[model samples]
Target: MKTANKPRTSGSGTKRNGAAANGKKMPDVNGPAGDGKRPSLYANVIKQFDKAADMMRLDGNIRKILASTMNEIIVNFPVKMDDGRIEIFRGYRVQHNDVLGPFKGGLRYHPAVNIDEVRALATWMTWKSAIAEIPYGGAKGGIQIDPSRQKYSINELERITRRFTFALGNNIGPEYDIPAPDVNTNPQIMAWIMDTYLQMMPPHERQRCIHVVTGKPIKSGGSLGRDKATGQGVVYLIERWAEEQGFDLDGSTYIVQGFGNVGSWAARLMKPHGAKMVAVEDVAGALYNPEGIDPDDLIAYAKEHSDIFGYPDAKPIDHMAFMGTKADIFIPAALESQITALTAPMLKVRLVAEGANGPTDPDGDRILLERGIHLIPDILCNSGGVIVSYFEWLQNKRSEFWDLDEVDAKLKKKIVSAYERVQGVAHHYKTDWRNAAYIVALTRLENVYKERGIFP
Candidate 1:
């Protein structure tokens, strides 16, 4: 696959004193460049790879190959709108690696989706799966259309998905690139992709193609406990951490940012564990009550009202205040960059469990570290989704479905075991969890790469 040239600013805008620009100095992955200030996603991914490579003393050739995506497909397809107009949408699917198995990751639907962002996400998936000891690689796809805008009808979305899937062709398969649900995408969307793939396959091929996609509804061969898998996994990690620290969750408090699938389910699971759901926030707004809000009641209310703002049981709070609220645990399940340096120090919590990818900026992470708050990094905390997605893929390939209880048990074991491994590394290295996790994952990837060696 041909790699796109890295974007460069010409003339005096370039920095001369920085590390060599000829791939000698690894790019700054965390530097701000977006909006001309935050670093681009591609730069961030490269920066991370460079850091891990340096620490592991990786070979130059392997570093370059691992740093660059193996495949990136950009699609500019036209979809007919409800008003009889053809709207051209930009979509991207990036496969970072397939060394372990077929690439696996989520397909997000949002206006902010970009090639750089998808590439970064796919790269992260590679590390995440490796860290979790899963037999998968990394790939990510996204349509740059905002689902909130009713510009496209359901039929149009289906058409777009089918076209994108078909465009992928042999690039994706039951043992190739498997796309699951991500931000703004759900089981229904996965079902659409599966149906579309089946429609294009022969009868015998269809049977083998069911594993091509995961996160489908259970009735459609999806895993039974997949819906709440990520959230449950987060709760499991929190419980393990609490036990390690001797913190009882019975009367503990939590502030959750994001009321979507992960956040909502996390609140519900933690509630039954005796944790008080004091604050829940989403794009609509935030709701808070020091005495504790019932997750069951809040979920029902949000279902009916579409937002947590008008819930009579809790007082409405500003989004900023929600972050600074006092709680035992604070979960950023909304989106990346929600927790920053400004918000990190203000958090009156003992732990920050990331439910979203890259939720904390580098600066914010430093602040949280200075304050002695334990951070259960995104790679370890939010791995449940992918873990169950792996299970779903396995069942699809074997044509054997497990019960909900079985799935849940397996997920909890995997997540808790991964958490303990991360914690052990943190203690052994005497470093924060994030660095410890990066070390652990980097070590695993490096070892595997060495074992496999180079293919001449």
Candidate 2:
């Protein structure tokens, strides 16, 4: 519990910009490269913050507060595997800020998990909630093992999750730090967190603590539209951007990277609106079918094969080809720094909708801007999940449940409002969308801090 504020370093011991500084090979983003020292995803986040902070002339005190995390919790928990081996897994929870309310973020399961990355993610969650006008902050936690390769049995995973939860202890609560699901994690995992946390609580408090974690199974006090919230948000922002830019979605083609939760859902939703997914690259492989790939078929293959490795309907494409493929729009839903200086130039789309957190580094972002590619920053682009998570939290607190239609409708309204606000700010400041987004969030936070003043 006391490990909540320990600053984490990337395993490689390289600075955020150090990887490139050391002449490391920059290639396609393989979902957060996990070699020795992983690049500072947290550094990328702070770079964005510093750029915006300087431009906005933010108060130095609040700027410092916003620059660092509020707490970072690291846990070394033991779990008995199905193989009868007791293994220890390292986990983390980085709470960025709670100036508005509770800290909310996702708990992921990935080999690339580290203090720097989670800290970056938690920081983004703070700005994201602020931009969405939600009364929540940011936090992120995950273990540093590849779930895909580990093949942990359900019982094994449940044990690992429960033990991790027990170790987290009172660091998480309904009105404190609430974590949802992230990469390789799902609603089922969220349920495990809820169940474990409740079991650890006082008998009288168990029933009222469902809000301790969100993105749970619908029957488990989860919101109806939570599963597709992030993807839906990505497309929502894209659709609005299209409307403003006079780009028609009906006949436009898009390329998506990381065909997992966000990419697959966005493709499926966009298909009904007549958009085409001409290319997709995932961990399994890359596929290109310029004639338009069927989302249903691809989704089915991914579900069965665990990756879209060899779908019969589409031809395999290399990562280079995947990035270089010409299309109307491109969505990077994979991991941070995917759109680096090398890959960014390969992108041939007029617009980029970032469905993943910090998909484009500042350098990649600069190139995209220079190339005249419109971008919807991750904070604004993939905020549908948190917005709906906020809804679920409110629902659980109020003992009210909403239907799918109601949930979707509210999500759309919130995203659209946020989109318009960011656009307005960008236009007024004559700045890029990424900077404008930060400006929007910072303004809200600044106003709050300015009005309330810092506590004694």
The numbered model that scores best in lDDT is: 2
Compared with the true structure, what per-residue lDDT tens digits does model 1 show for residues 136-172?
9999988877665345568777877877777666667
Q: Residue 281, candidate 1: how far off, in angstroms?
A: 2.3
How well does candidate 2 match the true structure in TM-score terms? 0.85
TM-score of each candidate structure, all chains considered together: 0.87, 0.85
Per-residue alpha-carbon lDDT of model 2 for 209-296, expressed as tens digits?
9999998898999899888899999998888888888888998999999887889999899998899999999997799998999888
**Positional deviation of residue 409's Cα in model 1 after best superposition, in angstroms:** 0.7
Candidate 2 clashes between residue pairs 3 or more apart in a chain or in different chains: 4-72, 12-37
Clashes of 1: 8
RMSD of each: 8.1, 7.1
Where does candidate 2 stray beyond 4 Å?
7-41, 76-90, 110-112, 144-153, 304-306
